[model samples]
Target: MTAPLLEVNDLKMHFPIKSGLFSRAKTFNRAVDGVSLSIQPGETVGLVGESGCGKSTLGRCIARLYQPTEGRVYFKGNDLVHLSHKALLPYRQNIQMIFQDPMESLNARHTVGEILEEPFIIHGIGDAQSRRRSVAKLLDTVGLPSRSATRYPFEFSGGQRQRIGIARAIALNPELIICDEPVSALDVSIQSQILNLLMDLQQEYNLAYLFIAHDLAVVKHISDRVLIMYLGQIVESAASETIYQSPLHPYTQSLISAIPIPDPHRKTNRILLQGDVPSPIAPPSGCRFHTRCPVAEPRCSETAPSLLEAETQHDARCLLINSQ
Candidate 1:
């Protein structure tokens, strides 16, 4: 098992909702509640769900951007939650994040070279000349030109900006990169290029990735395991191919069915899910998907299901499968 590279157990993050002039806490948005996951070294795990399902929040917690209200996040045998800001420095360098919007992530005033070199500077690596030399090679590694070092972010297209972001993330040579919707904003043609670039970088570095995206097809192409999140809870997790071929969770089945087959001749019984995702501030009791699940049993509304392996390594948090 290689003792999993990262282990997140019963992780929870709650944002308080305050009311009145005094701002007394009224309620809390349990953005992520009792979620658990693990990522082995050199493996890519994809987190997929509709918008506002807490995938990004989970990613941030794993990155230690937000303090978890509950549970533990262990990376390479170190507990991230207990680390003081100063003590967390080394872990920060080992885990990097690639944001969704490159334009927003990259500073407009900083040249490409400066942006990429900031990490090395923060971590205090390399001299000025060596840093400059590494900058050009990094640009080349991400398929950007060395001349790009001198240009502002606005001068490049969206794809190029993402490439620059990639260059910056890898500048420190981290082992894990949390990609938050990396290609959603790019045009289709450009998206493939970015995906391929990520693939190449992973192969070259033997890096692990926690790819968070709403796109199922994209996850299918890149991930070894796929996790389906809904209302801040994971409904299913399994080998990507297993989930695509025989999804155990009702929500997962619907999601996989929604993926469009390239061949028009092949038929797919698309399951268009009904009802909006329940609010995280007050998620539904028991099984969250009972309101929309076609095969939901009466007991589903009264008991929450824990994710457990049903066959080999396939896991699903659904009462139906638990009974079977």
Candidate 2:
């Protein structure tokens, strides 16, 4: 059997928050506490969670955009966590990122052609003429017209700009792409088009994806597996079908139940939590989800639950569920 293209082990990213004029005291916002997962070649792993749940931070860490606070990010047997910038250059070509806001990510000054060609230029892939040709192909690949390449980002609509971002990300033919809410900012109609484009590109290039999004329905459609995160930690990880069908974690169950049903005639039970997600800087004492978990037991508040396999190959971080 082939090995995974990416392996994240006990990964954490903590941003220090300074206080006071002298900044004598400092606190760390534990954006990502301990996230561990593996992604095989050409597989899509959907990361779903609420806002500020560290999904984007985790994606950035995997992309090596942010140096990890602790743990290892192994890609093809090498730990990327401590690799120097120069040392990591070669691996950069094998991994890429598509940020949530295309308007912010894309260079407003540069033409679409220039933007797409930047990756090849950075890696010194092909000469000027060849790079231009590659840029044209990338435009075509992302469903943008060749003429659009000469236009600046501001000239395009939100969806069009996102397509441009997608075009640029695949320009280097990276083995893995970290897509952080790539379609969330676009219209619902446009979101489908973008998702379809990504799937088509994945099939064409044999690409692997770390798809981060808040929309469970979208994740369900595109992902082979799903990872549910809360309070800077993964609460559950399982196959997409299994995660939706038999969610053991109360947090995961609540999230699934919240996905709107299309049929008005059908009745469904929605699991509503009591309060907001606790601040990651000072999270709950025991299970991070215990404060909001509807099915949380008395033991949940006193004892932290490690991520344990509740069923075959399916893991959840819940004492109540794991005990049963």
lDDT of 1 by residue, 222-287 (tens): 999999999999988889999888988989989889888899899999888888888999988889
Off by over 4 Å in 2: none
Candidate 2 structure lDDT: 0.93
TM-score attained by model 2: 0.98
Q: Which residue pairs in candidate 2 have backbone atoms (N, alpha carbon, C) closer than 3 angstroms, thus clashing?
A: none
Q: What is the TM-score (0 to 1) of candidate 1?
A: 0.98
Q: Give each model's whole-structure lDDT.
A: 0.92, 0.93
- Window of ten residues with lowest summed lDDT in model 1: 17-26
Instruction: State how far residue 155 of model 1 sits from its true place (Å).
Output: 0.6
TM-score of each: 0.98, 0.98
Question: Which residue runs does candidate 1 get wrong by more than 4 Å?
Answer: none
Q: Give Cα distance to truth, residue 247, candidate 1, Å.
A: 0.5
